[model samples]
Target: MNPGSEVVVTLRRATAPDARPAADVWLRSFAAALPTVVSPRSADEVRDYFRDVVVPLREIWVADAGDDGGGVVGLMVINGDELSQLYLEPDWRGRGLGDRFVELAKERSPVGLELWTFQVNKPAHRFYERHGFVAVEFTDGSGNEEREPDVRYVWEPKP
Candidate 1:
């Protein structure tokens, strides 16, 4: 394999050491993606939510850039059949990291996958759609903590 063409971004189960950085990724991407969507939680709260609730209950995966670059450029949170969260560093966008993460999610939940994103997050809509997810439902902000209008998307293996 050519050294220049080797893949830098790799995915693995997130460990305790990944908690802080993963939380940082989540917070940064969330804030950047949802500037117009009201969030009652601050950065600290977002971090704590990942460390306390998300990391404990879900399957957390991180995309590590290895020694040649800073580690953990992306993360995905999976809860059963749901792709609860997926985030990448601002610099990592458009670098195929999101598609790799979605492939990982598909590998984990081969039957189907589901996720919810704020209605204001247009980029997310585009990304998920590009990866074969379709909007299945929309809500008036009653089912989520942020109480923001949101949409649920689902993906299923092609028959």
Candidate 2:
């Protein structure tokens, strides 16, 4: 891939077969983006969660780069009004994929959407804010599995 060229990525619904790759994306992104936060679940556990829970019970989407010989580059999970997860491979960041994921989430839940990101994830704060999500609440870390302070963001379409 050239330095200035944009890689084509297709966003589509994740199937049961995508569980492993999606989970891999989540793990890599989390490790790179949130180095200070420790995940409670192991890598295998996370893959299992994706296989048994996320794929079956949530609205999951994957950014497929297979057309360009790249595998899954990103993953997003939405449940009801909550944007539960959004992760992109470390090398795939800043290419507008995250923006696309948020747009799709809004389309899926047009009324409003809510999400939580660790307070330390300033880049995420900026990204979500850019997408119209406002930080509405801050927590002291007790409510999350990672035990890291987090901030809640909400997005509602204008009237």
TM-scores for all predictions: 0.90, 0.95
- Per-candidate Cα lDDT values, in order, are 0.88, 0.95
- Who wins the lDDT comparison? 2
Question: What would the per-residue lDDT of candidate 2 be over residues 29-110, giving only the tens digit for each residue?
Answer: 9999999999999999999999999988899999998856378999999999999999999999988899999999999999
Work out candidate 2's RMSD over C-alphas.
1.6
lDDT of 1 by residue, 7-43 (tens): 5677999887788889998777777778777778888
For model 1, the run of ten residues with the poorest summed lDDT: 1-10
Off-target runs (Cα >4 Å) in candidate 1 are 1-7
TM-score of structure candidate 2: 0.95
Number of backbone-clashing residue pairs for each candidate, in the order shown = 0, 0
